[model samples]
Target chain A: MPNRNRLHGEEGRAYWSMVLPAFSIYLLVMAFPIVLSIVLSVSNYSGGKMFGGEPWGFAGLKSYARVFSDPLFWNALKNNFYIVLLSVFGQLPLGFIFAYIIYRRLVKWPGFWQGVLYVPNIISVIVVGLLWQTIFSPNGPIAEVMNDLARAGFQSRLEALFASVGGFNVDDGLVSKILDMAGPAALDWFSDPVPELKELILSYEGAPLSELIGDLCNLFVPRWSPEFLSKPNIAMLPVLFVILWMYTGMYLILFLANMQKIDSQVIEAARIDGASEGQVMRYVILPALSGTIVNSAILAISGSLSSFSLIFAMTGGGPSRVTEILSIYMYNNAFLGRPNLPLANAISLVMVVISFILIGLTKMAEKRYGGKEE
Target chain B: MSDEIKTTALGRIGGAAAKAAAYAMMLLFTAMTLYPIFWLIMNSFKSTREFQVSQLAFPKEPTLSNYVEAWKMGDFGLLFPNSLIYTIGATVGIVFVSLLAGFAFAKIASRATKPIYNGFVIGILITAQSLMIPLFLEVNLLGIYNTRFAVLLVYIGTGLPIGVYLATEYIKAIPSALIESARIDGASFWRIFAKIIVPMSMPVAVTLSILNISNIWNEFALINILVSRTELKSLPLGIYKFSGSLSTDYGKQFAALTIGMVPMLLFYIVFRKQITRGVAAGAVKG
Candidate 1:
């Protein structure tokens, strides 16, 4: 009795009107922007070019080259990977452990803790950023504890400037060849007393080996500044903490929901076999949850690459760009700086590409884990 | 008999230790989770002097003056209405459009329909980063760059893809006999859609509404770029300025934040069930 006719008439006309509005909006909002970003990236776009101003022109690959060459660009890319590391390496395992504890009834009031932990995810990023600022402020809790430790002669937490960065690779650099030419003086990096000298060749941070400017007089510098939050080497610690806090709850909810879906008899069979709790977890529970783990891993990886608002609110990529990620860097270019639209577009395009690539890698990983993309 | 008794005693002690450890773990995590927000609320009520003296202590004298001062400073009187207008207007637009499209796709079979639905589905994977530049240009081309309506359009536009996807998927599960019966009675497409499909799809409509409202309301990146007019800024955009506004008075800053927070928190608490369901559903779909 269904009118399964396949002819075009008034029926088709009505259908087009119904669907076109939403469809066109998607095309205009999502699809068009992507094309425009690619186009603008390859062209000259700056300083209100579109709003009744100068005409836009093509710039070719100049902007792309600039993006790749800047030290800050490299820093942003590296920082993005650090975020990826925190999400994949940091959030997933912790989220699973918490979810396991609650699901297996190893902890009390599982529902209560689940809801409490998820509270942060719903709050505004601005609030989370400011709240952590209170904890990380120079006179705030974390720094105060660090200061107390320092006063108690626990100086291990304090970083040494030259020795703290990426380690030296004497096997690969021109510096190594130069050291061979300059005799043993250049080879102090290999000597036992100058361990700090050995760490210089690791990367661009004081790579020349003579950039060591320490607090020799200790006049202006305290042995330990309470302003630990401002230090470039450690500013990301609080950001990572807040990130782990804000997101782990959502994943916990995710993993627990997956855990509930698992068949109980399988677990019961293992229990009846006299398998201990840890063994059941190690052998049975973990393998069953691997699919959800892979799915969330993909989610976390893509999410990390494009993260902006939280870091922007907290650091604004400041204290000398220590926490600057690619999105923040692009935002600075577009809205904050001279409104370098071309460069910003180039960066945005690159960010999209990177997110796609990361998502692809994770998808391949998901396939290996035997989970289809839902 | 003595060895068995000793083993039983050791098991009792071990069980007691395990229970205590579980309780401690739960309590520790609960504190870690809630303490920061708790600090925000407590400080919001404290005076400047107290805030300076002890960031952690309970307020010696709780007062509402900070709230009053902050409300005036933030001009929430204007922002609250703007935010409400944006949230309601965009949600309504998205829901209506999605319903129409979803019904068409689900019931009205056509050749082009399949490809169009697939197109919208691809929009899900497009991050805001990629869209940021072109959206700015599109708004400029349309000459709605700083207008509140521009923000509304973008919100509805972005919300459409997911809304349509969910609605289509939901409506697809309905029996085709309902539509055929209405068609046999000579009812028009819209009439049957309104009378039959609309009532049938209420469950998904509700889900879509909750998901759309939360996402549209909390959205920052798109609205931040589109709306430069200070008076037209939505709640999230407006609250972001507090980072710079009250950098000196920590209490007043927190008070402004608390004001910014109270509405969303209340909504979450009231509809916490809907929210959790929506989030879980989203996670499953993603």
Candidate 2:
């Protein structure tokens, strides 16, 4: 009886040993923190104070209320939506196009192209942020090129109209006088006005030449002038540009990989049935890739919601809170704002819930469409 | 005959156009992708003053002085060895522990242990970001904070889930008949694992090692939180500090970034096929 009992115990011990390592890791890394986050969210736990020093007391729903009432929180939520929209609508499709072009062997040296495309993904976010900041800065190469283009456009349009009226020389003072009266600050094409105008054109939607003229008229003619960054409706444009530039490549790569996995035979069959490329794409390829698209879309949405590093590194959620996402606001609340730990935790918890809800919806859609094949 | 030939010619023209259009799109994206890295490398050779004034222009005369300055000031020579020690130590420990745990899960059948295994699966759901602060406190409490050992422990713990999952999947594919045969021959369990199991699972091990190396090399937040001592800093943290200290020096910062990325880049190049296969397999298994 003793030997039989000992053998059973050894067998039990062998079984437990297999699971102990995994259990220990889970306990330390996952289970502990999840419990701690809930506790911290309920109680007042500031980083400045030690575990015992602070009057460890619970504050009920006050933290949640504070987050809801804050204007910065609202702004951040809105900005997050903007990022999600841009990433899903803009980045996903573009990524598919790129991946499709490369994977179909339409492009020579696909590996080199893949390497080039993958470069941005590998680089640190800080580096990408800094690179973009320089590119979009007022004095950067992009701005310089924009200014030159604006000047050339203005010159050609003015010359064409003047010459059409009869034999009118552009070198004459007539055009100069007209421009001086109508142009911003009577500035030449190479000056600040041109760059600003270029930026406005790149960002805002309007009739191109007319918009330029209207902007110039406003600048020169007083009544039409609007603060560029503070024009109420247009302030979000710069922030949008920055967010789009940073995340587009990441989403693109993900979607492209998914698109590549759609079997070619299905597409070929559709094509042989006299279906157009658009129809084949819409019917066969899109249905097959729907799960991947939805998964990527969900990821993009969550990523946008939590986006901090790029926005923080680039804009610091600046130009009057126009670009602040929730994570940035949460960071501010914890570190820079009132050091309101309860409020920060409350906001973070809300953000976490929002992320889960978004992911949950995507999963539902994915199931409806048929789950991704492994 | 002429009409038939003309229709065929038109079809070829259409196909060629489509191909050309595709190539055009690829070229455009490739340029966009290469631009930033190209900019970083180009700017790394320029003086700070020059970089500020002309963001896109090539340096009048490129220099290696920035690389030298970054190498010495960052104390990269010393830091590289420290990083290597931490990464290799943590990776070996994680691989070994996870392999043992994974093997047992794959081979053993104990009805009472199902819940425990399920608990390990739950670890995958929790994001690393959420646990960082709590883990920092725990690391401090354990009295290993600021030491290489603390960072190593955190790295191993963080890497455990994926490693175990991969190992379990790989081990499951190995036929139980082999283990049974070894057992029939009177081989001990330890000998069977070492001689039969380990050799067959080398591909998975190599794949896991590469994945862990890439992850640990690029890891920043954990290193930042766990190691307050500058002397024990990993490459990411070291480069971040080096960048901040030399604020005006774009050249040095780029050089540092380039240096930090080199090991992973080289690893990826050397083991591209394995790495890609590992990622694809791991994604499915995960």
Candidate 3:
């Protein structure tokens, strides 16, 4: 027993020594930033002042308040929720369905299907943004389809009648004017630098479908949609679309792998018990996948919240700050926001807090579900 | 007999219908997944005018000008080597460090070190996003901000947690007797690790290396922030430059994206099973 204890002590020393270097590195690189961000959040320092002899002073929660009260911040927050929801509900389910179909039901080459789904995930976000931008551009294929649908000759009589009632006259309506202007001239949708599209959209506040159609027509026609990087709202769409597209495969792969682990006998039993396909999916598959569902949802939410590089590359929070997510907001503040070092640090702190809350909540949920399994 | 035959026939019909539906869904998703890539590749060979005229359709007359233009404009020749060096160097460092740490955690008989081992798990929870600012400051202070070493160091630091976790889990499955026998023969800890643990953990190491290689190769944000010089930028950053320089040049941009992604795509194809298994294992474990 004494020899065993001595051996254990030796082992302990050896283990600690091995791990110490890596852990120390992680502490400095990871923990230091988090602590520093907290310190900076309450301080007052601007760009030149940061580099100069300006002393850090307490500002309490002023930066947080500033972010909370800013309309742009609220807009970005709302947009982020929209993105999160879209990813969790829209993309996650679609990915699962795709993964399920490929992995379980489909009898063909699974590798081929896997590769196909993973293409977007492998491509860079900038590339995805550019591809979608081209596809959705007025002169791009989708717009051409819309244009064809708009033409009087192309529409069915009932559709034409509905269009007229909807105030979409091919000859006189905003849609027609937009198609004429942008189809030929190539309109900048997001960044006109003149803010014509913004004005047009903001000006038509009360009208319903007709007004939106008019604004879109004006936006898409006559100019190339502002460089995706410059126009925040328009930029957000393609960026979100690409993100949704790219991550669908990853989430799909996860779900499919989990689905594979579900005992085949259980599924067979469900079938043998006369459960309909829909019923089997609703009861057996979904419940069995609860862990993954919760995990993926949390991941998607946290991911959307922390996303930076994509938005930075795609939009950069421009066209007057329409597409700024918290991560990008913090980054812009730190690196480019008037060189306001204190404010940037404050934003980073707030970001960390937000991420911590989100991840903490996820852990709680994971414990609730995963606890039983373990 | 007729009734039984009828039931069998109905069952066959139902199965056929389900199979058909499944195939349709798979085909549709496959198209959605593959079409963009196909379109990108096709666009690479087209002139700007051809791309503009038909985004989805095949080129009227294929041309190599886009690829040539993208290569020259993107400066991929310089970017590729920089990325290769960073990715290879970082991956090697990560694999070595993680293996050592993982072995220590898994095989070492130390109750006192459990907390420290668990602490690395916390590192998994703290992503790079949380520490970007501080890391930048640290790198800058260390005076290696724009150097390849800075980026490589960051990768090693960020990658350690997951690498250690994976290695520990894999190494734990190995019996302690194997190491004990080696030690009884008077083998040193280093020898045991090198000859026994390393050989036994080859599969996991291979999987880990591939995962790290792909991740480090495609990494953009850290490299973007750390490397200020354009020539030293990685593939993802190089593609970003291509996008910025030729903002309006869709054909060339697509060409560059296609070109840059080829290596990863090829890697995936060659090692699909290993890569997917590694990703799945990492995801579930995390």
Candidate 4:
């Protein structure tokens, strides 16, 4: 202890030698960038070598002002907010529920289920995002399903009309009537169903009630458009869905691992005391895991705010930046297009500020509720 | 008493129904998670004609032509090795450096130790997005931007905080008596670290390796920013580029995705237990 407490000479050098390599890289990679970003946020450094062609000048608040003023920036911020809300409210609760179910042995083969559930988390986010992207694409699974439904609806309606007319004759009036019934929103998509109808007329069987129901339901649902991916309002939904799919497993394991540490006797005692399953979860498990829940909320908020790769891979902030979260917005600004490095830095700084504020709020709430639970 | 019996009977029925619902929910989620990858794999083996006919259909006549085409077009031959080099290089680098630092931090007593340790932990809070722009500048300043070395350096750097945090906590749990005995043998610090501490910390090193390997393997954003060259880029970047350029070719795109994920999936299958356990252990500890 005496020898270890105070080192000198070669021993002191050894201590530093071990620590410096990792610490220095950390500074260069993480710490220095943070400071440099703050500085760059104020300066109008476009791109290329810093201060290369044009001298760097301070544009105090200009970059931030531009970001705040930009509608796309706000859209990106709003999307990021959706992601944060999804991660905190959607993924965490779902993950916690899954973890609880497995913990309580509510599902058979808990290990198998746990392993299967966690599969998405271990795969590359880009792969998951791309897989989902393809699934949502025009020729992908969703389009196929929707297209089938669209076809079925046309056939069923045509059949009903033909039965009313007492014939399978090719009537332009019947076709026009059906098209009118489909409404304007479906018009563009419903275009050119006549040839398909002619083909189906020769071999069409009577539609089942279930198929008719499905066809009816498809009318109310947003028609799957090939341009949906490029449409501003609808584009972010797929990215958000993929994010939920990809991350829930991490929190599941986090909760399950922490839950396992809660002595079995505690849960058993709760049950013995006539606490129903819901009561045990609400009273014992929830309060006991409140700390981990708060920690996970902090993780989710920061992670959501900073998430980049999946969105980058899936949407790349296209469709006029509707799907752009702050990270993607920052990346697109800094690296892509005109390369507004200062604006990117400004966006990043805003991200940092937002993360801190959210995390601080999470901590504050945790303290308040956690104190009450005690 | 009769009323109580009736309520208990209702409670039992409710509980059974709830259990059934939970099972159904788990099954649904499992399908949601696995079906896409399964569909991708199934579609990858189909002919372009067959895929266009029905994306949902099992490959009518399974073929490897798409795989061959994707392998050549996606530049997997180059990018696969590049990804391996970065993942392995960063993972090994993280393990060695963090082990050394963790040992020092745990065993040594110095005024500098606490602050240095805290600095690494503080790094856990700094998200990679905020650092991306400035790190791009820093990499350029260092003249290593668009190079594999930049990717390696940043990967190791971003990885260190969690690595060091986990290692320090794990190493601290190792008994001091072993270090004391080694010191009494007049062992130099290097010898002690190499001979005693390194051997003793194999568990944490394995966990560290697992965590870093998986993370670095999947990482894209940092590498995307750091290196623009196709040859220098990793699997995720390669797959991303392919998805955009090969958007029309469903077979080729699925083939490329399968290639991108297969190695990691294989790695997961081989080391499933350790990977899951190691991940849980790492997260819980951190």
Per-candidate Cα lDDT values, in order, are 0.74, 0.64, 0.70, 0.81
Q: Which has the greatest DockQ? A: 4
Q: What residue runs in model 1 are displaced by over 4 Å at the alpha carbon?
A: A1-7, A143-225, A358-374, B1-21
lDDT tens string, model 2, A168-261? 2223354445455455554634365444444544454434544544454444443222333444466567557755554565554555556667
Clashes of 1: 0
Q: Every model's DockQ, to 2 decimals? A: 0.33, 0.31, 0.43, 0.57
Q: What is the lDDT of residue A298 in candidate 4?
A: 74
- Per residue, candidate 4 scores C-alpha lDDT tens digits across A1-374 of 55455679978999999999998988888888878889999997877667566688888989989999999888987887898789888999999999999998877798898888888888888888788878877778888887778767666765677678766455667656655666574455545765544444435346454454344345534556575577788887778788888889888888998888887888777777787889989988998888778777778777876688888778778877788888888888876768888888888888777755764675576666554322
lDDT of 3 by residue, B92-195 (tens): 88788788888877787655447767767666656676466656766765678788877888888888878888888899998888888888898867788889
> What value does DockQ give for candidate 3?
0.43
Backbone clash pairs for candidate 4 read none
Per-candidate interface C-alpha RMSD?
3.9, 5.7, 3.7, 3.2
Candidate 3 stretches with Cα past 4 Å from truth are: A1-13, A47-59, A144-235, A371-374, B1-14
Residue-wise lDDT of candidate 1 within B1-286, one digit each (tens)?
Answer: 1123223565557546766776786678779888877888998899877886667778889999998987777777887888888888998888889989999888898877878997776555557655676688788888888998788888888788778888898888889888888888998888988898889988888777887776676677788889887789877776777775465577788887787777777887787767766666565534
Chain A TM-scores of each predicted structure, in the order given, are 0.74, 0.72, 0.72, 0.79
Instruction: State, as a TM-score between 0 and 1, how close model 2 is to the true structure.
Output: 0.78
Tell the DockQ for candidate 4: 0.57
Q: What is the TM-score of each candidate against the true structure?
A: 0.82, 0.78, 0.82, 0.88
